[model samples]
Target: MIRQRVIVHGRVQAVGFRFSARVEAQRLGVSGWIRNRNDGAVEAEIEGEAASVDAMLAWLDEGPPGAEVTSLSTADLAPTGERGFRVLS
Candidate 1:
């Protein structure tokens, strides 16, 4: 399995980005959590098969139509061994 931490920037807050991320991650069979950052970005960690993870990253680009993702920075990481995807408080 591949694990990754992603920081998505640009028009991410107050636009259902986290909610959409959870739905998309579940749909893609990814496991992790997504949350809003103080810096006005969306942060998430996704773990799954490489293909699924890659697919999820691609979805992060457009992000629920309302999100205008200007950039996404991804880094390889060890899996947190999380159970499922969720929207973090």
Candidate 2:
């Protein structure tokens, strides 16, 4: 398994981005957590199969229909072996 840290910017918070992420992550069988950053960005770290991680990242680019994802940044991370997607406060 692999891991990826994703930071999404622009009109992310209060747009159900984290909830959407939980849905997508569960659908893809990925495990990790997502939260809204103090700077109005949504950040998440996902760990799972390469294809699943890729799918989540791609979806994050657009996010839920209400989200206006202007930019996205991702970094490779060591696998955390996380299980079950979640929303962090």
Per-candidate local distance difference test: 0.93, 0.93
What are the per-model C-alpha RMSD values against the true structure?
Answer: 0.8, 0.6
lDDT value for model 2? 0.93
Which candidate gets the maximum TM-score versus the true structure?
2
User: For every model in order, what is the number of clashing pairs?
Assistant: 0, 0
- Badly placed stretches (over 4 Å) of model 1 are none
Q: Tell how far residue 7 is off in model 2, in angstroms.
A: 0.4
> How far in Å is the alpha carbon of 18 misplaced in model 2?
0.5
lDDT of 2 by residue, 1-89 (tens): 99999999999988788998899999999999999999999999999999999999999999998899999999999997878999999
Candidate 1 colliding pairs? none
